[model samples]
Target: MWLDKESQIDLLAYSPFAELITNITANERLNPLTIGLFGRWGAGKSTLLKLVEKNIEERDETKKKFVCISLNSWVFEGYDDAKSAIMESLLRTLMDNQPAFEELKDEIRSLIGRINFMKLGATAIKHGMPLVMSAINPATATLTMAQYFSKTKRKEILNDIKQVWNEKEIEEDRDTTVENIRLFRKEFSDLIDKSEIDNLIVMIDDLDRCTPERVIETLEAVKLFLSVPKTTFIIAVDNQVMKYSIENKYPKITEGSEDFSDSYIEKIIQLPISIPELSETDIKNYLLLLICELYLSKGVPSIKANQLDILLSKVKEDNIFVNGIKIDLEFVKSAFEQYDYTILDKGEIDEFEKMFDIIGKTSDVIASILKGNPRQAKRFLNSFLIRKSLAEIYYKTDRTFDYAILAKLMALEYIDMNRFKELYKWAIENQKNSKIKELETITNISRNDEELPEEYRKWSDEKLARWLKSDPIDLHEKDLLKYFYLTRESLDINVSVSDSLGKAELMVFNKILQSKRATEYSLLIEKLKENKDIKYTKILDALIEEFKKNSKLLKKMQPLYICYSEYRSEIKDVLKKMKITEINLQTATALCSMYQADKPGFSDVIKSWTDKGLAQDVLDVIIQEK
Candidate 1:
């Protein structure tokens, strides 16, 4: 019931890698080619190599063997010496590919032994080797000399092997270091010839996953020691990441000269082939194929796995190879339309088609959100399916889930988690207040005034509002809420619920205004008063609307009057947003009554009003109240 690992199927048809393999196999008698299979991690570079390996193996048995060796740099990163470890892996894999070459095995073993352990900071001392007495300092040597035989015997022994270290010796030591590398390369070339393979394709995958040091070490070893005749090193790594690794390895070169590090990497990777991102068509086909696979696995009624195979074949047939080049998606849709999906109900088939269409339409958006990464797409879909399966298992009822709605929400969840939580909370609260447990009542209905509950203010997110109003699917709020509760990563959703009571009160006030009949303002005030923490200033925006529509309603709002007496700071904000012209007689009277009782400097603020009549009217209303 999940999208299996990458390379489960050649979703892109493996054409690119097949061509690459063909080219590699055909190119003979050339020096070792270091081809960089460049792509971001999880962009299917490893999968491409797997397909190439499969293609090579499936080639004509009579032809020379394409000795494919797959190396994961991440695996060798943990070793003491990444350089030595990589070389050993290469030589060992080459030997394993053709173990019959006993003579070549000895040469490889000897060459591998020449790998620089000291340079990699690994040595016998580090591996529990006992210290030799002769290597000890003069003081320790003197003590050892006494313990062994005598001081006289030690002087004779010291002169026999001890020689003065000099500059010439250091020069020779440097030469030996260079000579060992040349010797190793020579032996590597001979081993390749002895193996009797046409081309030794060393596919190094996950180089980007290793630490910078390991990456630099492995690449350095490949270029210096292992780049020999008849070898093809296909390195899968991101160019930027490798560049960073190179810079990290040689900071002086990176800081002193920019092109120096770049040139070094460019020289090592002779043929760089970047793996392209999955196109929109490619993602659509991938998702559809995966959906079909899940359906088949679950033995869902309409679509079978074999039918999907037929669909794939149909698409393949339509892809006419023009000059050995064909667009893969040119016929996918046509094949989908023509495929007879058995005796499944037309309605069901139409539903699936709609699901497919929705996914296809939103493919680009999803790709962008996931950075055109096929693995992330698969993970998101897998997560959705897992949640859906869990929901079915737990509920085990006749309740149905809409794939389209869930897909939309899943994309939102993948993009921004907090917004998704807010939307889910809103939907759940909306459905609960609507008193509708059935899907029919929840779907295709506008929010009525009575059904709208006091907002927790958590759902006031503009993005959430836009997404819900956009109506990507005619979703039942109850179904979405159920999915939300099921799919949430956390057990408790209320932890992040907004504590602000202003937005919640605003929602309640908006609902009251939207009421067809005049809402009983007293009832709304009672609801507001229940939460004594309500700040009048925070919800002044909501009050402005009520004042405009039905000014008398304010007189009946005891809770708001109490807030006016308690929370004075909110008064200026409410006053600033208010219009003197819109202040009806009753609302003016209510404000005047508050000014009389509170006497919170309402006179000075009102005296400066531009509209003399409106200001004088309010002043006169205050006198009546007094």
Candidate 2:
């Protein structure tokens, strides 16, 4: 299995994009630039960031040098406010790295003192303190400590801050919080200028993971404090996630008027460099390289490290007319020739070429399902290898199982797990070559049919049909016990860890299950507003188990919780699957009471309750509410 980390090598042929960004960033004319490196999560945004940094570092021939720095913005998310966190981190980095600024250590230390004071003044209330800094603005330094803290303690905290300016020497007019903020920016900028560093390049990563507040705060800090001359900030974040963050922080925009988030990010990010989703060709080449590299790592005599590059160069060019990498026999022959299999005789070479063909054919399906994501491609490849490894060891009697068949079945399992299980069930009950009659129409048919089985009808989807028509399409002749044997552990493991909720989720989940009073669910209500889908599923799963474990305690609030969730559409599906025997008129009344409109719009949900043994009269009353 390969480690899921950023790589220095450009395996996805993403070097051209990385190099373009490096050129744009390295041009000193673009100093004071804020470049937003936008991509979906796991689209190699982080790896591309590394490539850009490496490119900049390699520019020793350029007369000017860069003082490159990296800040993982999410690291500061939970520990403290984003603005101050970034500010202090900058001070520490500059102070620690630049020995030329050794003489200014005292000044930098003084800067830290002032930042701490401002941070405490700005965020004292957010940490549950009653101190009102908003009223007596931190910019003005007129802090109000009397409401909560003891007067003596307040004085001690204030008096402990280093005296940056003497009261006797300076007028009272200059001691304002706003003045200090202006002074901090000037002083920090001065420190960078004085250090004699030609330029400062700070790349911020993982801002996508921050809360909306932190996301907006860090961006504000970058725009406000760090956009100085001779400085460039490359922030790697998902554009959509950033839009969500901006919308969350400043959500007062009138609908259809304009998207405030678009304007907001555009202003701060001078140049937004978006990394598009990997194309089908890019993903195919990526998978090809990954498989070859895996084999190379295993000391495969057929291929060498440099030859992998030769293969990459040829496939990435994709001159199919001249027989380069494509989904057919020609590409397989080309790969084997590039592999330089002189040690192998004609038979071994033929066998190895067949092995190469499996990667080619399977990758086409994998690429489509992976949605052109390099990280997803890597992960799928890893999982496929793990299953292959386990299949070899688990069924030692069937070590010669055709890998093409394993790849085909695993692709189905990876894509539609439920369908995979159904197929497995079909395969397990019979001998080799037993036909799955359901596939007769679903794979061959181009459109949906009312008479087709519900599960099989969904298989008529274009992508699934494409997968079904791939080589080894009819598994009727194959004994798939070997396939099921590998997925046995995987199937069990998926069930075991399916509902691994985070700490915040689990905490609120426990309270939801244990609480006797409806008033005690403020946290549950809050959590529902955020990440509600997963939270709803977890609650539903937990309630199912709770019903099995203790029917008495589970009956009170689980249905109420599910109904109170404003996600009426999703709750309808969850309720359909659930057996909430306690979903009576009182529970219905409680749920409807919170609905704003006369039409509460869960007619089907209430109608389905009669089948779960709801009283006919009670069902009539609930249905009337709709």
Top-TM-score candidate index: 2
For candidate 2, the 10 contiguous residues with the lowest summed lDDT are 164-173
> Candidate 1: where are CA atoms >4 Å away?
1-5, 60-64, 99-103, 115-174, 252-259, 293-313, 317-365, 435-472, 476-479, 490-626
Worst 10 residues of 1 by lDDT: 164-173
Model 2 Cα lDDT, one tens digit per residue, 475-578: 65677777877778555533522255667667666777777776665455445646644545445444444544443542333344444442344334555555
- Which pairs of residues clash in candidate 1, taking residues 3 or more apart in a chain or in different chains? none
Q: Write down the TM-score of every candidate.
A: 0.61, 0.66
TM value for model 1: 0.61
**Model 2 C-alpha lDDT versus the unseen true structure:** 0.64
For residue 233, model 2's alpha carbon misses the true position, in angstroms, by: 0.6
- Candidate 1: tens digits of C-alpha lDDT, residues 29-74: 5447888888887788877888777776677353245677788888
